[model samples]
Target: MINPLAQFALLLDADLMAAALQQHLPECQAGDWQVTGCEIQHPRYKTYRLAENRDRSFLSLVYHLRGRHPAETTAEQRILYARAYLGQRSQQAYTEAQANGETAIHLAELGMVGWRFPDDPAMPWLAELMDSRQIAELEQRPISTIEIVNYRPEIRCTARYRFAASETEPARVVYGKTYADERGRAVYTNLLTLQRQSVAAFVMPEALAYDAGHHTLWLEGLQGHMLTELDFTVGVAEKIPALAHALAAFHQVTPPPLLVITSQQQLKEWLKKADKLSHAYPTIQPALTGLFNELRQDCPEFEVLGLIHGDFHIDQLLVLADGRLALFDYDELAIGDPLQDLANFAADLYNYPYPVAVIDQLVQTLFTAYSAANHNQTDAQRFVWHLRGQLLTRAYRCFIQQKSAAPQRVADFIALALRPWPLAD
Candidate 1:
């Protein structure tokens, strides 16, 4: 029996297939050009390089033409048709992967299959098709191996493997890193580190790596305890106290050094430069600008500029076996008013489902711990103002984004920000 892939190659080459395609797609034709080999380059379309002799060559394909069908003579219809075809093919490939028991296969990698039969002289064609640098790298690293242990589409890229070594068994290692898309939208990675074999564990969930292309290796996974199964949820009454204690412990540690941010004029210039770095939302830009302005104004009055977790949401906090809450993901860590950190915690509280009494209790516990740690250097009232300003700014940004897809929860949060719950006097 012929290989299924080989059958696919023949189908790709047959006149019948071309004829059928021509009925709907007149541009596609089965010429005397011969197909040596075909390989999957991307998920959208199969690329075929044909040669009449050893020198003269041409490329052609029958791909999904997106947009509307051509009514008269326009490229728009063909483009639309191609896109639709690619979408259908991508879905089909995903369905097949699910049927085969594969977990979260990337649709973009498997869609629109392409491969030449072994009988055909396609190896040379394949060699010629690769980029010069890629070809050189492949030759230089002929013995290298790649092992993919686990992968979640747009979430995590976990792998374990070894580079070529002479005397030793390939060094076994595991890596886990978060992934991002073309738009720079980031995903969270749970990095659980074990300091000892004790029952207590400190799991740190952070943006492990900024580069989406690079992988994160965790050697501890092979030898240390796997605490991924640990349960975080306990009695709702204790969560606030637990979180407050954790935040206090984290804030108590002396940071490396106080980072001096410039005045509002300088900050505006900095923001202008930062705006060019990525495609920030238009609504978010103004709010971020306002946030920087407020911080500059408040910085002189507030002496302490310590290490603060910039985005301390519920997801960033990990509860250990010993009942200690550890903070992780310091990618956005910056030296700012400690109240900014408090604001982040407050923002998280707004998002998470917990009683108002619990929030009050948590705030009181946090203030007490912070005051004790700082030797009464910091005032709670000033921090509250900072928190309020940050909240107002964040609320405005979220509200703008919500305008397009306004959910009830988001609407409620906006309302809450506008008319805040009065703090206990």
Candidate 2:
């Protein structure tokens, strides 16, 4: 039996994939751009990061099924949709090609579907926001420059707006985030609620404004380095108690109405992810299926839903100059099992490109501190269950994200999840 995604596997073959991408991509057709990396963005899409041979400037090119297969969007309709956001002048931004039997739409960074608003100057609030008037906390000044902090094509873009220094005030920086849809409004609301609560264990950067028309959210720039920058093998332990306390305090807060995801729902998602992984890496299908079945058989029936940072990880935490920890990226905040946050954080530690023993020590310290701070609310058995589930989820993410040493990491994570109950001392 031929796997439906067998053809897509070619996208991961660095050599073949790069050759194909360079051949079809309009900008790369001249042979100046080379594929630097590629990762699965969605089941039907992959993003190939290309670098120019001269200066090495990066551009993201997405190979997706726009008006194809499951979506049923026609090629003509897809082209029209992209042109609508990018204007008619963007004739060279996308070109279609066949990947096996599928019609794959290759879109350049600026012409990415559903997320062209960030580059659209004509957006209703863009000029005002770009001019730095949207930041009420800062003394208004002319914009000196703008820097794109991070961009995930077809998802979101975060840019830093730096204002020129005035006689009385120093230059200030504010962040603006544009989403593919109205999701930014909800994240803005969550930040507002977090700010009002003022949880002392940590600080949440201020949410400045939300423009529903353009699906953008503005936030005050924070002065901090991400927690991941700290020496995880050494001094990180000292910060664990505070980190644990912050997470505990955050969990107790009454979050605004949000989606409720239970363990059962998560298991269902994992099953789907497992299916995707099996199709992509056929060799692991047997092992993946057996492990998933075991997890399903042992799945916990009870759940305690509460506020959680849906995607909590070390990178999402920042250590401020004043020694306070600031949390960012609340787009995934939801009403779910609080244990999921703890598990998510712990699971992410395994991917840090460090020694397994070092990661194990850090996770143990984190779990100990969290247990103490949360007043032992973490059920021993349930916590382990959540941990195992989170490990599988992280493993799946590692595969799709194309992280360094991904195959080994996925196997290690799955092995850890299958470890006997206490999860090693």
Candidate 3:
């Protein structure tokens, strides 16, 4: 009889699944990042973390199908109950492990279909999509072979494909991103539409193909120097203008159809979520809450209901060899106050190198370019408020994600939050 663990891994790549399982349950010492302990209440929901920092932090993946209870008032008790249940499950898994030599996790039991198929040189549908689209970059050649470069389980797969024809064809150098589920499929589809609309106005990846059934998207690999990769102090002078111009042009048009945005109500709900993470950031939480209160108290009117790249940042842009700036990753596209994009970009500037003054100058450069190109006359006070709120939320998230951020960096964000917004005067 085939072990359930082996069967589960067949859907995903075998090695990847083993690496995850091997990290936990000390039984597999082949790698570092050992887990101190883990409770497996079900084959589907496995929770574990590094051996040293088990209490301070841990990792957990709860599948959507696992009867996850709705957000309830008694979250503390519910979390306690779930942890206890996981202990019970772990006990059962240990007993089975002793019976058999080894029993890895059975992820497929939880409804996961990993898309790493090594046997088929090419998936039929993928080939058809490329062929039908008549991808000009391919030079009439077909995708000869492929390999999974990266896979984030239940999220996305980054695959690199080689062309069957002449090696010199630009298509030979290609990378594709495949979504794990239907929703990811729809988002990427929307991205293609937005990309097409921006042509002649913005530099985005050349669309090659969109495979809806499999949720795979192919594009011309720009393979250029990304703005994020450069030292901003050296590159910002030239690159910032191009980025600002592209964004201004994109915001100039009416928002793409069906682009959804969560407005004031969403902000309120997210602030409540921020409250939950308060424990993780005791020192910063006070300032954060104050800004949150300000945002909540003064819900400003949208002077311009314009387009925004909801998740814009330095990393989302590229400085191609041909002296053009390109943008990618449209997953967070939304229709909102255009200033939101500027605020998002400013916050991201902190992530790069250089002194606060240098960062501030770059931001000002972008803002100046934006204002000149688009002629936005939004109220200065409103821009200040919007930027403050953006800094607050960004600080909260930065503290949450990078817990070890320097005290000074957190302080910088707080100061930015409280100070009058840049370009306000």
Q: TM-score: which candidate is best? A: 2
lDDT of the structure predicted as candidate 3: 0.55
- lDDT (10s digit) by residue, model 3, range 1-425: 22222333322332443344333323234432232222221123122223343222212222111111233322211000111122134445435534554322322222321111221112323333334234434446666655545444345556666666556654456767766555546566666777667444558776677667667777767768767777778776678877777888888755556565544754775486456435444676787677677777656755467777788888777877887888877667777777778777877786665787888888788777877767765455655566676666665555433323434566567767776654767
Q: What residue runs in model 1 are displaced by over 4 Å at the alpha carbon?
A: 1-175, 178-239, 257-300, 354-361, 372-377, 393-411, 418-425
Q: By summed lDDT, which 10 consecutive residues of candidate 1 come out lowest? A: 76-85
Q: Order the candidate numbers by lDDT, best to worst.
A: 2, 3, 1
Write candidate 2's Cα lDDT for 358-383 as tens digits: 87778777888888987876676666
Q: In candidate 2, residue 337 scores what lDDT?
A: 86
Clashing residue pairs for model 3: none
Give the local distance difference test score of model 2. Answer: 0.65
What CA RMSD would you report for each candidate? 17.1, 10.5, 12.6
The predicted structure with the larger lDDT, 1 or 2, is 2
Strongest candidate by lDDT: 2
| Candidate 3 stretches greater than 4 Å from native | 1-151, 162-171, 195-200, 376-378, 406-412
- For residue 85, give model 3's deviation from the true position in Å: 11
Ranking by TM-score: 2, 3, 1
How badly does each model clash, as a count of residue pairs?
13, 1, 0
